[model samples]
Every structure is written in C-alpha cells, then in structure tokens.
Target chain A: MKILIIGAGGMVGRKLTVKLQGAGALNGQPITALTLADIFAPEVPQGGIKTTSVAADLSRDGAAEELLAERPDVIFHLAAIVSGEAEANFEKGYRINLDGTRLLFEAIRQAGQVEHYYPKLVFTSSIAVFGEPLPAVIPDTQVLTPLTSYGTQKAIGELLLADYSRRGVFDGIGIRLPTIAVRPGAPNKAASGFFSGIIREPLAGLEAILPVAETVRHWFASPRAAVGFLIHAAELNTATLGQRRSLSMPGLSATVGEQIEALERAAGLDAVALIRREPDAKIIEMVAGWPKDFDSQRATDLGFVGDSDIDEIIRIHIADELKGKIGRGAA
Target chain B: MKILIIGAGGMVGRKLTVKLQGAGALNGQPITALTLADIFAPEVPQGGIKTTSVAADLSRDGAAEELLAERPDVIFHLAAIVSGEAEANFEKGYRINLDGTRLLFEAIRQAGQVEHYYPKLVFTSSIAVFGEPLPAVIPDTQVLTPLTSYGTQKAIGELLLADYSRRGVFDGIGIRLPTIAVRPGAPNKAASGFFSGIIREPLAGLEAILPVAETVRHWFASPRAAVGFLIHAAELNTATLGQRRSLSMPGLSATVGEQIEALERAAGLDAVALIRREPDAKIIEMVAGWPKDFDSQRATDLGFVGDSDIDEIIRIHIADELKGKIGRGAA
Candidate 1:
C-alpha cells in the first residue's frame, strides 16, 4: 500500500504519521511507500517504509497535480486554514480552503482521465459547519447553516466530495471531526482554545483562564480519536455510505464543569485550583452560537469510536503526550 | 431602482422582465434603468424605463466584472445549465453553474471595495438540491444531499450566497423553486418535462406521454407564480432571513391523477383524453428519486405564494400563454 498525508506537519497529522509508521500496514496491506505533504516540508518518520516529505501550497496552480503525480493508493486530505484565520482574511480563506480543495479534486479527476486510477480519499471536515439556532442534540440530518466562512468552505467541500464520489472520479469519504480537546501544545488565539487550555494547562501545573461559564457545553474528541477516524474512514466499505459521503464523527459532549471535574479526578484538587475564573464576554457570545452536542448516530453505527468521557480524553492526552506522567507540582 | 436580470431570455426571466415593465416600480422605487444579460442578447422589453440587452457568457474572464460595472441596485441571477445538460456535460456544468456564480459574487465584492455598493441579489435555486431517502414532506431544515451534479452546484451556491451575505458583501436571498408546471412552449428533454407536457400538449389537442404512474407526486409552481416569487424576494426585508439565506419556495404538491382531473375540469374530457399512457422506464427511474412534497413554511411565512392547486396552474397557463382560449377540439 502507498499513502499520502496532506498537512502532515500539524499535530494530528504528525500523530497519524507516527501511528501509520508503527503499524507498518493499513487495512491489512503492507505500507511500501509514504508521502507527507504540507505548506512546509513535514518531518520524515523513522520506519521500514520509504518516506518523502514535500512542501507545497495546494491553492497554487499545478501544485495539486505535482502531488498526485505518484498516484498513492490512499490520500488523506487534512489541510485547512483554521476558523479564525479564515474569517480574518476572506480572500485568503476562500483561496486556500475552497479553491485549494476544488483544485485537488479536479487534479485527481484529470489524472484518472489519462488512465484507470481511483484512490480512496479521506477528507477532514469540521463541526463549525453547524451554527446558531442549533438543536440541543444535532441529528445526522440537520441542515448546514455555517455562520463562519471556514464552515461554509467545509460545507462546500463536503458537497463536492459527495458529487465527485458519485461520478466515480474516486472513492471519497468526509468525516466532520469534533474540536480536539487536551490539544498537545501551548494555548492559541482560537475561541475554542479554552476547551483544551483549561485541561492542558492545569495538567502541567500552570494556571489557565476559563473564558466561559461552567454551564457551557461543546463536543470533543481527543487527537488519538481523530486520527482513528481518518484511518477508519479510509478502511470502511463505501458501499454502505451510499451517495452521502460526509458524516459527523462520534464525540463526547461535556460541560465546562464536567471537564473541570474530569481534571480534578485525574490530577487532584491542585490541578483544578489552577484554573482561573476570568470570563471573557466576547468568547461567551461566540460560544453561544456553537453546537452544544450531536447525536452522531450514523458515525457510531458505522463503527467509528469516540472517547467515553472527558476523563478518557484527558487520560489519552496524558498517555500520548505526557508519557503517562503528571506535572511534579500537581502530583 | 436599477435592475439586472442575468438570464433574461429564459421563460421565467422573460415573464419577470414583463412584470417589472408593467409595474414601472419595485418596493415603491421607480424603475430608472434595466439590464438584461444572457448567453445571447435578450429582447429589450417595451417600457418607459431605459433597457440594455447584452450577450455574455459569465464563465469567461471579465464577463461578470463587465456586468457589475454599472452596479444595478437589484440583481436577479436566474441563469444556470438545466439539470439534464449539466449531468451529461460535466465540465460545462461546473464551468457555467458553479464558477460563473462565484465569479459574479466575487465581482460584486470587488466593486464594493472600490466604492460603497451593495446589491440585493435574488438567486434562483432549484428543488434538485433535494434527493432520495427524502421525507414525506421535506422541512425547512432538511440536509442537502443532492444526487446530481446540478443539485450539487446549486447547494454550493446556496452556501456561498449565505456566507457572502453574512459578510455584508451583498444582500442575498436564494429561492429553491419547485418544478415549474404547465411550462410554456414545446416539450424539452428534462426528466421533469412531462409534469408540464401532460397539461400543455393536451391543451393544444396533441398527445403527451405520461412517463410514470399516476400516484407519483412532485412539488410545483407555475411560471407566473415563479415570477411572483422572484419579485417578492427582491422586495423582501432580508433581516428576517437571518444568516440562513436560502428558502424552499411555496409550491403545490400534486400527483399525475390530480393533474388530469384538473385538466378535465378546465377543458373537458377531450383535453384529458389527449394524454397518452406511455411509461418510459428511464424517466420512471429518474422521477423516483425526486422530492414528492415540501413543507415550505418559511417561504409562506415570508409571504411567497404559489398556485393553489393543479387546476390553478392550468388556468394561469391558459390565461398567460393560450390567450385565455383552449384548442378547438378541447373547447
């Protein structure tokens, strides 16, 4: 088997690369070659498989063609301009998120016209596709009414993915991933950053600001689970998916209080005490429009698994990022 | 008020142009200038308002920019490659439907950057955006799972329209029109053509094939009602639409049997007898996937109206196209 992972420099992409390297195979087929691509050349993982790293901007003309020249058996498209960046820069957002994705799909179709070539394409969508007036528990059949440009671009990508798959250009699947909690990095400017920061910072014995009230709830999956979704999507029988190529992946829904409770369970009261109650009204207003929970029935029925609760999500982060160790101060 | 109609040569477009001319005003603003653009130059309507007819293909570079140079106050975008053509000619469909629409929106945004200019954009979408596994009555919140390239394109357009409108680039509204029943002129190759053909051809004392069973139901609005929907959309206060800019227009849901009964009531049994019972398996399979009905609550609440029944649809066609007279044999 051959594999291509776009955005391989990102955290989830890097973890996915490592997982693939350790497994040495996918769907029971041995991995002979792997290509990791991003805006910057990604790190080459240590493995028996032949690995190549390429730096390419997909929005540029002919860039997608260059990447597809090798015709990898499975393509994992994980690259995107994050929500904040996309909303801040309109032209750049549409260029990178919308035009870039379409260009990639078009390149794949053009490549197939030369010869018989069809690869399994796994695309990463986002929960941002759902916006205000959301039901308490979003069902699989809810309409897409994205409030942000990033969400609109992802929705458009989902539509394109379905159409292209139906036309037999390639076998495609789109998985709408939840916000990754306990993200293994420093806090950023994202409005949803607090979801991870509150848990991640306290685990490291540092104080983190709680932007919203404890009652605020949102959907989440750990980085490990997100990677698992991409792999599962690639391995699944598309015949069952039918014409609807996109699906909301299974996730755990938790309130801020529940997340704090899980943190206390994991690292004792000291960790929980580290969270500062500094509410930001801007974030509160923004978070109000976000989806609180999802049924995710279709994804669960399809065998895609999620973290059991916030506790499991935190545990996964500790095991994966912290080598199963808490900060000395918190310990 | 200055008005621009992109598909001024088509049936509904022509009707809308005539209606605008007769009214001499929209939303209490006097009509000062009108521009009609299409693949071919549209006929200049006879009216007191100054009218310009231009031949242009929007997919080409500079075409949309040229159209937007004058910045018409109300822009009615009713242009698209019909479903059958879009399905058969893939590249042409995306080129004209998707790319063309995006370029136009981009042009409007660019114009706004140069000066203070924002137009009320009324986009004509289609029921084709809905597909199989449909509910008995598709509600306002039904997820778009388009089964055709055309529907995929329209769904993408709706997403773009909403995002752009939310960003203040344009005041936009997308109306998802049902199949226009009793469509004037000769029968065409569209899969849904028989819905109109059975009524149209028979009224003209000619045999029209009924390609599906009588029980097969579908949503509909007449050409006159479609024009009304467009005008109402143009004049509507879009604040109520919120961020969800697209709507399924009010349409009557009727089966072929009801249509025949309505025709018999209009022009006696002779008109109903002219309908031939020839079931084309290809069309039957195609019709099976279409939407049977729509709730259309949002559109109705917004004051968009439709023909009351199949009887009203036939009556409007006869009043509008047949000079208020039936064929000699039917009469």
Candidate 2:
C-alpha cells in the first residue's frame, strides 16, 4: 500500500510516519512506498520502504495536481494554519486552510476523470468547529458554528469531504481531533498551548505558567492517539459512515485540576509545584469559549479509541517522549 | 439606503424587489438606489428609486469586485444553482454557489480595507443543509450534514458568513429558507417542486402530479414570506445573533394531505381533484430525506415570521399571483 501524508513535518505527522515505519504495513497490506509533503520538505523516515519528500504550497495552482500524479492509495491531509495565525491574517488563512484543501479535493476528482482512481482520504478536522454557547457535553450531532476563521475553514472542509465522498470522487473520512495534550515539543503561542505546556515543562523541571482556572475543563488526546485516529480512519469501511463523512473522535475530558493531579501521581509534588500560577485573562476568556467535552459516540462505536484518562495520557507521553524516565529535578 | 439584490430575476428576488419598491424604505431609511444583478440582466423594476440592472456571472474574475465597487449598504445574496442542477453538474455548482459567494465576501472585505465598508449581507441558505436521520422537528441547533452539492455550498456559505461577520468584515445573516410553497410561475424540475405544484397548478385549473405520499411531511413558507424573511434579516440588530449568524427561519410544517385539504377549502373539490397521485420513485426517495419540520425558535425570537398554515400559503399565492381570483374550473 502506497501512502501520502500531507503536513508530514508536523509533530503528529512525524510520529505517524514513525508508527507506519514500525508497523511496515497498513490495513493488512505491506507499505510499499510513502510520499511525505508539506510547506517545507518533510524529513524522510529511515525505513526499508521507498520514501520521497516534497515541499509544496498546495493552494498554488497545479501543486495539488502534481502531488496526486502518483495516485497514492491513502492520503492523510493534516495541514492547516493555526487558529491564531488564521485570525490575524484572514487572506493567508483562507488561502492555505480553505482553498488549499479544496484544491486538493479538486485535484483528486480531476485525476479520477482521466482514469478510474479513488483513494482513501483521511482529513483532520478540529473541535474548534463548535463555538460558544456550547453544551457541557457536546453531542456528535452538535452544529458547527465556528467562531474562528480556522474553525470555519475546517467546517467547510468537512462539508466538502462529505459531498466529495458521496459523489464517489474519493472514500473520504473527516475526524475532528481533540487538542493533543503533552505535545512533544516546546511551548507555542496558541492559546491552547498551556494545556500541553503545564505538563511538558513541569516534567522537564521548568516552571510552566498556568493561564486559566483549574476548574476550566477541555477535551484532550495524546499525539499517539491522534496518529491512531488518522490510521484508523484510513482503514475503516467507509460504507458505514453513510452520508455524514465527519466524526468527532473520542477524547479524554479533564480539567487543569485533574491534569495536575495526574502529574502529582506520576512524578511527585516537585513536578506539580513547577507549575506557576500566572493566570492570563486573555487565555481564560478564549478558553471559556472552547469545547469542554464531547459525546463522540459515533467515533467510539466505529472502534476509534481514546486514552482512558489523564493518567494514561501522561504515561503515554513519558513512554514515548521521555523514554520511560522522569526528569532529574522531578525524580 | 442603497440595496443590491444579486438574483433579482428569480421569483423570490423579484418579489423582494417589488416589496422594497412598495415600502420605499428599509430599516426606516429612505431607499436611494437599487442594483439588480443576475446571470442575465434583470429587468429593471418600475419605480421612482434609481435602479441599475447588470448581467454578470459572479464566479468569474473581477465580477464580484465590479459589483462591490459602489458598496451598497444592504446586499441580498439570493443567487444559486438550484439543487437538481447542482447535483447534475458538480463543477458548475461549486464554481457558482461556493466560489461566487466567497469572491463576493472577499470583494467586500477588500473594499473595507480601502475604506470603511461593512454591508448588511442577507444570504439565502436552504433547509437542504440538514439531511437524513433528521428529527421530526429539526431544532435550531441541528448539524449541517448536507446530502447534496447545493446544500453543501449553502452550509459552507453559512460558515463563511458567521466567521466574516464575527471578524467585523460584514454584518451578515444567513436565513435557511424552507421549501417555498405555492411558488409562482410554471412548475420547475426541482424535486421539491411538487410541494408547490399541487397548490399552484390546481389553482390554475391544471392537473398536478403528487410524486410523494400524503404522509410525507415537510417544512415550507410562501414566496411572499421568504421575501419578508429577507427584509427582516436585513433590518435585524445582528448583535443578538452572537457567533451564530445563520438561522433556521420560521416556516409552516404541513403534509401533502393537509395541503390538498386546504386547497379544497380555498377552491372546492374541483381544485383538489386536479391533484394526481403519480409517485415517481426517484422523487419519492429524494423527498424522503428532506427536513420535515423545524423548531426555529431563534428566527421566531428574532421576529422572522412565516405563513400560519397551508391555507394562508395558498391565500398569499392567490392574492399575490392570481389577482385574488380562483381559476374558472374551480370558481
């Protein structure tokens, strides 16, 4: 099975690449070749499988067509402008997030017109699709009224995915991934970054600012789980999805308090104490509008799994990123 | 106030234009000018107000920019490829419905960048945004899982409207109009045309085919009421909409049997007898997936009204289109 992973330079994409290399196969078929494409050429993973990396701006005319020329059997589309950048620069956001995705879909359809080619398309959507006035536990059927431009783009992508899939252009599936917690990287400018930073920094014996109240809850999944979702989506019998191509992937819901509690349980009081209480009103206000939890029944029923709790999420991070050892100060 | 109607040649657009002419004002401001644009040059309405009719395909380059050069204060975007056409020709549908709408919004944003220009954009969405597995009474919060390309385009438009509105690019409102019953003029090829045909053709002393069973209920509003919704949307203090700009507009929910019964009451058994039970399997299957009813609480609270029942719907058509007279066969 040949595969194409767009946005393969990102952390989740890199991790997914490694996982695929380790498995050597997907959907019970051997991984013959892999093409990794992103804004900057993605790093080619060390594997027996043939790998090619290309740097392409998909929104540019003919870029998507060039990528689809080889006709990869499964395509995982995860590239998107982050929420902050999209909100700050409207044109760029729509260009990359919305136009880019549409161009890719159009490319696939055009390719099919020349030859009978239909591939499995797994698109990564986001919970940002749901806006304020959200119910405590958002059902799978929640209306998509994204407050941010990024969210709007993702919602539009979901619509396009469904329509294209229905028309038999591609066997498409959109998985609305929850925020990845304990993200295996340094802190970033995203308002949701604190969710990961509080754990990642503290585990490294560095002080991490807690931007919101402990009572504030949000949905989460480890990066490992997110990659799993992409793979699972690709392998699924799409006939079961019917007309609605998107599914809100199952997630572990936890508050800052619960996350801290899990940290204490794993790495002792030293790690918990490393979390500095410097609340930022801006993040608090923004986080207030974010989805707290979801009843992702459809994804769960379809066999998509999530971390059992905050403890399991942290454990996975340690085993994967920290190599099963605590930082010196925390230890 | 300057007003622009993008689909002034269509039935609802024409009605809205006439209504504006009758009122001579909107939001209590005196009408200064009107611009009517469509695929073909719309026939200029007879009115004291200055009017410009333009032939334009909005999806083409520079078309939207040309339309926005004057920056009309209120823009009613009522243009779209109907469902049947959109389904048959995917490229045309996306090009016209999706790309055209986006280009218009982009033009408005560009104009605002040059100088302050935030128009009240009243977009006409459709009940097609909601698909099968629908509730008997679809709530205001129903998920937009459009089953057709047209619905997908409209749903995408709603997302864009909300996001752009939230960003202060434009004061936008998307009204999801129900099936417009008793649609004036000859019957068209739309799957939902039978809903109007049973009432319209019979009132004209012509036989009309009922392609679906009488038990099949559906949401509706008259063409007059649809125009009213547009005007009301244009005048609304959109602050009440918050992050959610799109609304399921208030509409009457009635079955085929109820419609025929109302026809009998309005024009006796002779009019009801003109309805023929000729169920086309294709139309029946298509109609089965349509939204039946709506709990349009938000639209109602926002003061958007609809015809009270099938009787009022038929009455409005007679008063508006038939010169308040039943056909000779029924009279």
Candidate 3:
C-alpha cells in the first residue's frame, strides 16, 4: 500500500510515521512507498518502504496539485494551523485550514479526470467545531457553531469532506479528535494546552500551572489512540458512513481533579504535588466555551476506539513517549 | 437609508424590492437611494428614492467588490441559482452560490479597512441546507447535512455569514427560507415548482399536476412571508444573535392532503378538481428527503413570522398575489 501523510513534521505525524514503520504495513497490506509532506520537510523514518519527504505549503497555488501527482492509495491530511495561531491570524487560518483543504480535495478530483483514482482520504477535524451554549453532553447530531476562526475553519473542512465524499471525488473520513492528553511536547500558550501540560509536566518532576478549577472537565484521547483512530478511519467501511462522512470520535471525559488523581496513580504523590493552582480568568473563559463531553455514537459503533479514562490516557503517554519509565522523583 | 438588493430580477426579489419601495423607508429611516442588481437588470419602481438598476453577475470577479464600492447601508444578498440548475451544473453552483457570497463578504470586510462600513447584510439561505434522515420536527440546533449541491452551497454560506458577522466585518443575518408556496409565475422545471404550481394553477382555473403522494409533507412560507423575513432580519437587534447569526425561519408544515383541503375550503370542489394526480417517482424520492417541520424557536423568538397554517398560507396568496380575488368556482 502506498501512503501520503501531510503535515508529517508535527508531533502526531512523527509518531504516526514511527507507528507505521513498526507495523510495516497498513490494513494487512505491505507499505511499499510513503510520501511525507509538511511546510517543513520531515525526516525519513527507519522503514524499508521507499520514502519521499518534501516541504510544501498547501495553501499556495498548485501546491496541492503537485502533491497529488503521484496519487498515493491512502492520504492522511493532518495539516492545520493551531487554534491560538489561527485565532491570532484570521486570514492565515482560513487560507491554510479552509482554502488549503479545498485545494487538496479539488486536486484529487482533477487527478481522477483521466482515470478512476479514489484514494481513502483521512482528515483530522477538531472538537472545536462545537462551541458556546453547548449541551452538557454534545450528541452526534449537535449543530456546528464554532466561535473561533480555527473552529470555523475546521467545521468548514468537515463539511467539504462530507460533500466531496458524497460526490465520489474520494472516499473521505473526517475524525473530530478530542484534546490530546499528556501531549509529548513543551507547554504552549493555548488555553487547552494546560490540560495536557498539568499531567505531562508533573510526571516529568517539573512544575505546571493549573489555570482553571479542579472541577473543570474536558474530552480527551491519548496520542497513541489518535494514531490508532487515523489507521482505523482509513480502514473502516465507508458504506456504513452514508451521507455523514465526518464523525466525533469517542473520548474520555475527565475533570482536572480526575487527571491529577490519574497522574498520582501512575507517578504517586511526588508528581501530583508539582501541580500548582494559578487561576487565569482569560483561559478559564476560553475553555468554558469548549465542549465538555460528547455522545460520539457513530464513531464508537464504527469500531474506532479511545482510552477508557484519564488513568489509561496517562499510562499510554508514559508507555509511548516515556519508554514505560517515570521521573526519578516518583514516590 | 441606502439599500442594495442583489438578484432583484427574481420573483421574491421583485416582491421585496416593491415592498421596500412602497414602505418609503426601513426601520423608520428614509430610503435615499436603492441599487438593484441581477444578471438581467430589474426595472426601477416608481418611488422618490434614487434607484439604480444594473445587470451584474455576482460570480464574476470584481463584481461584488464594485457593488460594495457604493457602500450601501443595507444589503439584501438574495442571489443564487435554483436547485435543479445547481445540481445539473456543479461548477456553476459553487461559483455562484458559494464563491459569490464569499467574495461579497470579503469585499465588505476589505472596504472597512479604508473606512468603517458595516452594512446590515440579509442573506437568503434555504431549507435545502437540511436533508435526509431528518427529524420529525427539525430543531434550531439541527446539523446542516445537505444532500444536494445547492443545499451544500447555502449551508457553507451560512457558516461564512456567521464567521464574518462575528468578526465585525458586517452585521449579517442569514434567514433559511422554507420553500415558497404559491409562487406566482410561469411553471418551471424545478422539483419543488409543483408545490407552488398545484396552488397557483388551480387558483387560476388551470390544470395542475400533483407529482407526489397526498401524504408528502414539507415546510413552507409564502413569498410575502419571505419578504417579511428579509425586512425583519435587516431591522433585528443583531446583538441578540450572539455567536449563532444564522436562523431557521419559522414556517408552516403541511402535507399535500392538508394543502388540498385548505384549497377546497377557499375555492369550490371544481377548483380542487383542477388538480391532476400523476405521481412521479423521481420527485417523490426527492421530496421524501425534505424536512417535514421545524421547531424554529430562535426565529420565532426573534420576531420573524410565517403563515400559521396551510389555510393561512393560501390566504396570503389570495391577498398578496390575487388582490383578494378567487376563481368564479369559489365556495
């Protein structure tokens, strides 16, 4: 099987590449070739498959078309500007997230003009698509009323994915991933970043700030689970999806206190004590608008899986990113 | 108040334009100038306000920007290709319905760069935005999953309108109009034309074909009600809309049997006999996917009204289109 992974330089993309390398195949088919693309070229992974890495900005004219020239069997479109950056720069967000996705879809359609080439396109949408005045638990049928530019862009992408799939341009599946917990990276300025930082930093025997109340809840999935979702989405039966090509993926809903308790279970009191409560009203206000939990019936029924709870999410991070080891300060 | 009406040549547009002209002002403000634009130039109505008529295609590059050059205080963006035409021609649909709307909003935003100009933009969306596997009574929070390309375009327009409105580029309100019953014009090939035709033809003492089962249900509003929605949307306190700028306008839901019964009550059995039952499987399948009813709480609370029932809808047609006259065979 041939594969193309866009935004392959990002954390998830790198992890996905490593996972794919370890598997040596997808959907029981050998990975003969791989094309990895991003704004910054990704490093070639340790794999026997023939790999081509290129730096390309998809929002640029003809960039998407050029990327589709090879026409891989499966396409993983993970490229997008982060929420904070997108909110900061409106035009840049729409250009990269909205226009870029459209261009890619158009390019794929145009490529099939001479011959039938319908690749399985897996798109990464976000839970940001749901916003304020939200239900306590958003159902699969909840309307998308994104309040931020980034959310709006992702919602548009989801709509386009469904339409293009319906038109037979490509077999598309959009997975609305929850906030990835225990993110294996340095803490960022994003309001939601604290969800992961509070857990990740403490586990590393480092101090972390908790911006919101301990009772504040959010939907989460581990990076390992996210990669699994990507693979499953690519392999799932498209016929069952019908008209709704995009779906909210299943996730574990947990409060900040639950997350801390989970960290304590894995790393004991020493790691939990590193967390400091430093309330920031701005972050709290922003996070409050986010969807707390979801009844992602479709994704769950379709065989997609996520971590069971906050404890499982924390364990996955340690297993995957920390080599099954804890910090020296662990109790 | 300077007002601009795009698609002024269409039936609803003409009605709205004439209504505005008759009102002499909007929101108690005097109409100083009116700009009417469409592919075919609309005739200027007899009014004291200065009227400019132009034949302009909004999809054409620079057309939207040029229209905004005048900087009208109020804009009624009612331009669109019909469903059948859009379904048959994919490129035309996206270009006219989606790209045209985007270009118009972008032009308005860019204009604000030089000088602050936020016009009250009343965008005419359609019930086509909702599609198959629909709820018995679609609520205000129903997810937009349009089965047709036309519906997809309109749904996309709603998203853009909300985003643009949120950014303070334009004070925009998108009203998702139900299928306008008793459309006063020549019979067209549109799938939904028969809904209007059955009433229009029988009222005019002509034979009309009922292409679906008597039990076929759909949401509807009169052309007059549609015009009212535009005016009300234009004059509404937009601050109340908050983040959700687009709304599902209130409409009466009635089956074909209910419509025929209402017709029989207004006119005699002779007028009802003018209706010929000739089932078209294609139209039946198409109509089956349409929304049956809606719990348009947002629109109702916002003061956008529609006919109370099928009987009231027929009365609207009589008072507005027929000048309160009925056929000689009336009961």
Candidate number with greatest lDDT:
1
User: Candidate 1's residue-wise lDDT over B1-331, tens digit each?
Assistant: 8999999999999999999999999999999999999999999878888999999899999999999878899999999999999999999999999999999999999999999999999999999999998899999899998999999999999999999999999999999999999898988999999999999988888889999999999999999999999999999999999998999999999999999999999989998899989989999998999999999989999999898888899999898988888884432
True-vs-predicted CA distance for residue A323, candidate 1, Å: 1.0
Lowest-lDDT window of 10 residues in candidate 2 chain B? Answer: B322-331
lDDT of 2 by residue, B1-331 (tens): 9999998988899999999988999999999999999999999878888899999899999999998778899999999998999999999999999999999998998899999999999999999999998878898788998999999999999999998899889999999999998887788888899999998998989999998899989999999899999999999999998888999999998889999899999989998988989979999899888999999988999999888888899999898888898885342
Q: Estimate each model's TM-score.
A: 0.99, 0.99, 0.97
What TM-score does chain B get in every candidate? 0.98, 0.98, 0.97
Model 3: per-residue Cα lDDT at residue A26: 93
Top model by DockQ, which number?
Answer: 1
Residue B141, candidate 2: alpha-carbon lDDT: 83
Candidate 1 residue lDDT tens string, A72-132: 9999999999999999999999998999999999999999999998999999999999998
Query: How many steric clashes between backbone atoms does each model show?
Result: 0, 0, 0
Q: Which lDDT tens digits does candidate 3 get at residues B284-311? A: 9999889999999889888988888888
| Tens-digit per-residue lDDT, A1-331, candidate 3 | 8999999999889988888888889988998888999999999888777889999999999999888888899999999999999988988998999899999998998898878899999999999999989899998888999988888888889888888888899999999999988788788888888999988888878899998999998999999899999999988989999898889999989999999888899889999899999999999899889999999877889999988888889888888777777785441
Candidate 2 error regions (>4 Å): A328-331, B328-331
lDDT of 3 at A85: 94
